[model samples]
Structure formats: structure tokens, C-alpha cells
Target: MTSPSELPSTPAPTTEFEIFRGLHYRDQPLVLPNAWDFASAALLATEGFPAIGTTSLGVAAAAGLADGAGVTETETLAMARRLAGLPVPVTVDIEGGFHEIPSAVADFVKQLAACGIVGVNLEDGRAGSALAAPDHQAELITAIKNRTPEVFVNARVDTYWLSLDHSSTHDRVRRYAAAGADGIFVPGLTDRTGIEQIVAATDLPVNVLYSATGPTVATLAELGVRRVSTGSLLYRAALSAAVDVARAVLQDAPVSSGIVTYPDIQRLLPAR
Candidate 1:
């Protein structure tokens, strides 16, 4: 079994970061799938995803902590350390920076960089039913960039996500872009018109969440999106499948014919 430290503790090549950033601007959008832990990330890398994003929901839920509560900092870094050993670039979701002070967020990002993570999703969504003041979120983004200039910082605006009047959504995007964000991420924004508006408004890469009711990856690429993220969809779908399988097995129903072998994951685990 290969421990994280035993595998390697060095940052990936600088080209890895460039390759990840370049993926966003290719003719096709970078379709990023979110992974919760080592096995999930390893599986995605083995399946040939050039990069993977961490889902805060899956990280918190796996440990009985609630997402967006700022309680999983240690666990998040721990997972980052493990996933650093994978063959592809890794980006993390540090929800709301997990701290109020801008410098603290910067310091946290430094830690992630040490783990070889090349990018992060820092959102403006708040704990309460409100959005972080755009100016404040920009401050955090600036501080993180000042501290970790090498890490790709994706600034996420939650205006559309919170269902707030997005009269100033474009303004928020501009603020983040000015603050040195490497990309712009807008979750819950699916309208082709609105997406095009945002895309034309900034030179930074535009990232949108994938929606079942909205544009597919190819459609998003046509609309000028640079990246398409699955967000928590993979994690949620994994949870659903586990529950459904458990119900079937407990109810004496015939189980599915096969399951993917997890021996490689076992090999990667340390023997007690």
C-alpha cells in the first residue's frame, strides 16, 4: 500500500498547471468531475480525466460535517495530501475560503499549493442566506493570489445561485477578475443569453456548472464557456447508487451482476 508521503511529497511540474489552464481555453470546454477522496480521484485519473476538482459536500458529508460550515479545514487538507499523489492536476473547493480574514484564506491556499494542488474554487456564497459582499470576496481573492501566485484561483460568484437579483452579477465578475482570479465560475447560471453576456464581459476563462435542464458540455462550448464542472453531481449520484444498492440487498432482491474491483485501491492503502 502506498502512503501519500511514501508516494511523493513534491509539487507537480510547472507544465501541469499550464496544461490545466490551457484545457479551459481549448475548442472544447474542460469538463471537470469533482472527486471526494483518493479512490474517487484515482479512478477519475485512471479513466483519463486531465484534472479533477474536490467537492466540499462529499468531503464534509463523509465525515459527518456539514458543508459550508467552515468545519472541514483539516479534513480537506488531509484529502489534498492524499490526492496529490494522483497522475493528474488537482483543484480543490475551499468553500468561501473557510475563513473570514483574507490573509487566513491566503495561508490556507499556500497549504494546498504545498500539496501540489494547482487550482481552487473559492465561492462568494455565505453561511446565511446571503452573498458575500463582492468587494470583500475580491479582497480575499487578491490576498490569495498575492500569497500563492502559482495556484490557479477560480473566483465563484453566487448571485445566480442564491436566486438574488443579479443586476450586479457582471460587476461582481469584473471585481474578481481585477483581483487576479485565474477564472470566473458561476454556478446555477444556465441561460445561454446570460452566459454569453458574462463570457463577453471578461477575458478570463468562464466556468459554469453543468445542469440537467440546461446546456450540455458541447452546447456550453458553443456558448463560449471555457470550463464545465460537475460540481457535487458525481458525489450525489454515488450516494444515490449506494443507497439503492443497499435497499435492494436488504430487501432480498437480486443484486446487480457485477461491481468494479477495488483491488487497486486496496493496494494503495497502508496495512494496519
Candidate 2:
């Protein structure tokens, strides 16, 4: 089997969208770190990430809203506007497009594209943990593409995440690909064989949610995965660190070293 690294490199990208799209067709999979807010996004950008993504769960949780409940559209858009100035391109998760109507969903994505966002993760999973009809989801993908051809539409299939009828993964991905999705994201798929099969199922880039216990980045790259996302993991880990440090303070235990200082965070903010 030929490795992506051995393949010929493509021409240089001329646009932000092209830059982001090119990240998927590289020697190694694009390891995307999901940020919940401007500070997190900025920090990741300064740390040298090629691009940044917004975790729907992280955004919803920070705003005290439930993830995938379709209640954080405003907050999500607000975050996109705030992160537009970051050095790297940004993609956001618009859970189920925040509306049942395909056009309305596309309109919301247009708002993000206007904010200079280069990509979006539109999932088929809906409120109440139900998966939308494949055709309906495809309609949503088509509408977004028609409205904003430049924005990378990462059509997400939640069959694996929701653990309902895993057999539908191939058909769903092919349907979205036919509908013009720029990529396919399967969030709970981590096993090597599963990843390989899905990557083989479509010509579009394949994105998998990063799992601590799953295949490593090098392994995923070898499996032909194109994009690996740390969805909500960073935010959750930050929360866990905060609680742990507080507990240590109460116990008079030595704090963890190498933690980011207050000044480091202050520096990440705008000068004005």
C-alpha cells in the first residue's frame, strides 16, 4: 500500500479555504485541537496548530447549555466572530445546523463564513439522541455547499457515536459525498479496521474524533485518516486540572509545575 507521504505533493494553496483543505491531503493527518473560547483558540494558534476547531460540547457547556440540543447557535456564532482574527483558519461545529430546515441551516453557516470561518462540522445526530434521515442530512449538506461553496463542509455521521446501526456508516458517507460534502467525520470511530474501512469508503477527507486510548496519530495517518480532532477533550482536561489544583491547594500539596502562568493567558488576549 502506498503512503500519503510517498504521493506527489499538490500545488500551493492560494486561499484560506484552500489552505484548510490542503491540510487533509498531507503526509500526516491534520491533528486538529478543538477550542471552546477565544482564549483557548488563541493559545492553540500560538502553540502552532495549523488550524483550530470549536467543540460543540465545550461551547454549550461553557454557556450552561446542553450539547447537541440546538440551543447554542448564537453563542457558536459569537465565538466564530471572536476567533476570526486568529492566525490559523477556524472551523466550528454547528450541531445539526441548529434548525430542521435545510435553508435555515445554510443561512446560519453563511453567517459563520462571513465571520471568516473556513469550515464547519455539520452532524446528523439531533436532539434526543436521534439520527436524522440520511436524505435529510444530505439535503442539509447540499444546501450549505450551494450557499457557501468555499466553506469546507465536514458532514458528520453519528451512527458510530450514537451506536445505532453501525452498518449504515458506508451508505451515509457515500450519500454525503454525493451531496457534495468536502469531508466526512465519524466521531466515535477509533479502531484501526473501522477507520480504514471508512477511509476506503469515500474519496472525501475522513475526520475521526481523537480518543486517548485509540490509535495514535502516526497510526491513524498510516490508516489513511486525514483529520483527527480533539473534540472537547482539551476543555474537559482543563476543567479537570482546575479542580485538581484546587483540591491540592486545600491539601497543602505542591502544585503541578509547568502550568501556564496568568501572564501567559493575559498575553494571549488582544492588546487593546
Candidate 3:
């Protein structure tokens, strides 16, 4: 692995970058699925999703570490490297920059870009359930854009997820937009009124987290949201299915759940 300090100042053009960015504004809102590893990502690609995103929760839990604690940097990068060969564009959830210095954030993203990831989720939430000052978060976004301009920077604002009001969110989004962010993500804000306001507030594409109780994708598209992400939902569902099937088998009861065939999974790899 190339050390962050030795990362190149400029990166060559990535083949998937333009395609990934264009998916945001297509006829339908981009419904991004979060994948934890190569098999999950490759399966989704075969299932016809145009792009894939990495879930920090799934990545951390699979490695027996905690999410949002800034402990998964190495693991996250390693997973990105392993999944680099997938057929679709891959974006990663890099929680909270993982370092105090803006340049270090740039260096970490540099490594992922080298691995061919086309996008990233850089959030503003920190440890201890607090939010980073808006200026500080925007500085991090600017640094990433400076070092890796080809990578789509999805600037995540965790205000609603942290149970805060919407008063200052527009301001925060504005600051991040000026910093050259390719898009804006507000994970917990689901109401159309607020969603509409955020989309109208900036020219940047607005990305919302997929909420079962929230507006559907078609509805969100009508209201002008360009992207909706399934963050960690698939990972949690996989865990539940794993436990359920195991319990059924041990009790000598019929397995009453869906299963993927071994041959189908084997097809996910490219022919060598």
C-alpha cells in the first residue's frame, strides 16, 4: 500500500467517474445500495444496480470493530481494494474524515481513489454524538476536492440524524457546496417540505437516506431529490436472515427463507 504522505498530487482520469456522477440526475433518483464486501457488491451489480456504496456499519461490524468511532480506516481501505474489481462504480462511507487534519483526510481518500472508487460519503458527525463545526467540515471537503478532484464528494450533513432542527442545515449545505462538493447528503431528514427546501436551496444534487416510513423514490424524484441511499439496511437484513436460517436448521425445522445458489454467487467474478 502506498503511504498517504507519498500520494500523488494529481490523479489520472478514472473511467467510471463520469458514469457514476451522471447517475444522480437520471430520470429516476439513484437508489444506492450499501455493500460490505466483494460478494455483496458483485451480487448487487449482477442484480442491475448501476453503482455500489460501502456501509461503514457493515464494514466495522464484519471486522468486529465499532462504526463512527474512526477505528475502521485501515479496514475500510482494505475492503475498497478488494472490491475494486467489481463491474459497477463504488463509493465508500468514510465516517468523519478519520483524522483531525484536513490533509490527512485527503491522503486517505487518495488511497481509495487509487483503488478506483469513484465517490465517497464524508460525514460531519463526530464521536460523542456531537457535530463538527460547519466551517471545519467544509474545510475537510475542500481538502478532499483539492487532492482528488475526480472523486465525487458526497458531503453528509447529520443534523437531523443527531436530532437537531433544520434551521442551520441550509447554511451548512451552502458552505459545503461552495467548497466544490459534487452533491449533498442529509441522512435523517425525510419530510418532503424540508427535502424540497434543501433541493431548491442549492444547485448541487440532494441525497437522502432511504427510509421505509419516508417518501418513496418516485415521490422523491417528483420533489427533486436526485439520490436516495440504502445505508446499512441491507447489512442488518443479511444478519437477521443469517440468524433466522441457522435457528431453523438447528431445530430440525424447514428453512423458510430465501437463499442464493452457490453457482449464482460464483458468477460474480470476472473470467480470468
Q: lDDT for every model?
A: 0.90, 0.95, 0.92
lDDT of 2 by residue, 1-272 (tens): 98999999967899999999999999999999999999999999999999999999999999999999999999999999999899999999998999999999999999999989999999999888899999999999999999999999999999999998798989999999999999999999988999999999999989999998999999998899999999999999999999999999999999999998899999999998
Residue-by-residue lDDT tens digits, candidate 1, 46-115? 7889899999999999999999878899999999999887888999999998899999999999999988
Choose 1 or 2, whichever is better by TM-score: 2
- Error at 54, model 2, angstroms: 0.7
- Which should have the higher lDDT, number 1 or number 3? 3
**Lowest lDDT 10-mer window, candidate 2?**
6-15
Model 3 Cα lDDT, one tens digit per residue, 1-272: 99999897755435798889989868889999999988999999889999999999999999999999999999999999988788889999999979979999999999999999999999988887888899989999999999999899999998998876568899999999999899999999999899999999999999999999999889999999999999999999999998989998999888974599888888776677
Candidate 2 scores a C-alpha RMSD against the true structure in Å of 3.9
Q: Which of candidates 1 and 2 reaches a greater lDDT?
A: 2
Off by over 4 Å in 3: 1-14, 270-272
Between which residue pairs do clashes occur in model 1?
none
Q: Candidate 1's C-alpha lDDT?
A: 0.90
Best by TM-score: 2
Query: What shift in Å separates residue 145 of candidate 1 from its native position after superposition?
Result: 0.9
- Model 2 segments beyond 4 Å from truth? 1-11
